[model samples]
Target: MVNPGEVPTASVSDLPSQDLVLLDVREPDEWAAGHAPEAVHIPLGELPARAAELAELPDDKPLYVVCRSGGRSARAAMWLNAAGIADAINVAGGMKSWHTEGRPLVGDREGVPPEVL
Candidate 1:
């Protein structure tokens, strides 16, 4: 469990079975390379401005935040939690871990297989 003031984190293997929102904070290029199929992209730098967008997402479920690695997502998760975006949880190890664990990933371009960038 995460202590107060600390962002909660979960590895790909430990993701909850319950439905939840996946938010990707990676850069546009990175996202184009590969990302969780259902994730909503809002690059980390744009999160503050796009805050209202996430408000439209369902709130009953937790939000899983991810980036190239854990660093950005951790900060994003913490900020979202403080900003009342949702009960944010950082996806530890980010896309690297997700790919290594064989979780589904898709790219923006067609006919080109996705890869963690």
Candidate 2:
């Protein structure tokens, strides 16, 4: 198992827009509830199948995976790394940290609309 403390960590403020891809692994319902603007909603379960869609991200640029409170994203990052994406990094605190730090988010509390699917 990947340990969060063993990897390099980045605070929300430390995240660079160009050097990182914020991959949100939360479900559609959670993503629709709110997500960081810099984040891409991939849902943990869908990542393996959707790997091709992430080609825009260079192999060198780190992918910062995040979820509701961090668990899922950490696992997703591990899986991505095993699959050959070397720079996958799990955001330690997930969206909970973002909210704790007062970062702004966009989404509907009711849920992500079906049209966005």
Candidate 3:
């Protein structure tokens, strides 16, 4: 398990959801461009206000946080951990790695091929 800035992290290989929750903490445009098909989108800017909402998630499950790249997700993960969400982990390389490693992706529009933005 990768760890950065005292927070846990996941990799591209662990993506596409392996019976875990994937949170995409990217902006609306980035999320719209492409993201893990099963990810839960919650823009980083909104995390402060929405942190409480995540408390309802199952504690036994891991919550993998992701962004276009690892930057934002790392901070989000740190914030989440400080917020007492121990299972929150950042996806090391984010969607860039996922797409590069041939992982699945989905766009906001139907029938359109997803592309990382």
Candidate 4:
């Protein structure tokens, strides 16, 4: 079992699109504001109810979890590991870092550019 507080982490730059499952755990408003286009939206609050949805993902690929900052994603990663998704990892610095690094984001609200809320 993966230990709590020991989830693996990687910077946004290190995350390549083809290799892993990007799980965005932020809430709806935060997600709608901006998010990695390829990321799967399973808000942290809904994870318990949607845990089974993750079973369809390939086991060979690790699950990279992200939120507005690192805090919520870290909790989500720990919870995922505890719930038997052993390869879940927290995206260090989260969307804030992703935005700062100039990574592409999907949604923009009211003509505003995509940004971490």
Clashes of each: 0, 0, 0, 0
Quote the lDDT for 73 in model 2: 81
Please give each candidate's TM-score: 0.91, 0.78, 0.86, 0.88
The stretch of ten residues in a row with the least summed lDDT in candidate 2 is 108-117
Per-residue C-alpha lDDT of model 3 across residues 20-117, encoded as one tens digit per residue: 68889999988888888777888999998887778776778878898888999998888888767657888998889989998788899677778998
Name the better of 2 and 4 by TM-score.
4
Model 1 per-residue lDDT tens digits across residues 1-48: 334347888998988645758999999999999998889999999999
Task: Enumerate residue pairs that collide in model 4.
Answer: none
lDDT of each: 0.89, 0.74, 0.83, 0.86
Model 1 alpha-carbon drift over 4 Å, by segment:
1-5
Clashing pairs in 3: none
* Full candidate order by lDDT, most accurate first: 1, 4, 3, 2
Clashes of 4: 0
Best by lDDT: 1
Candidate 4 — which residues are off by over 4 angstroms?
1-4, 108-110
lDDT by residue for model 4 over 1-64, one digit each (tens)?
5554587788888887565688999999999899998888999999999999888887888899
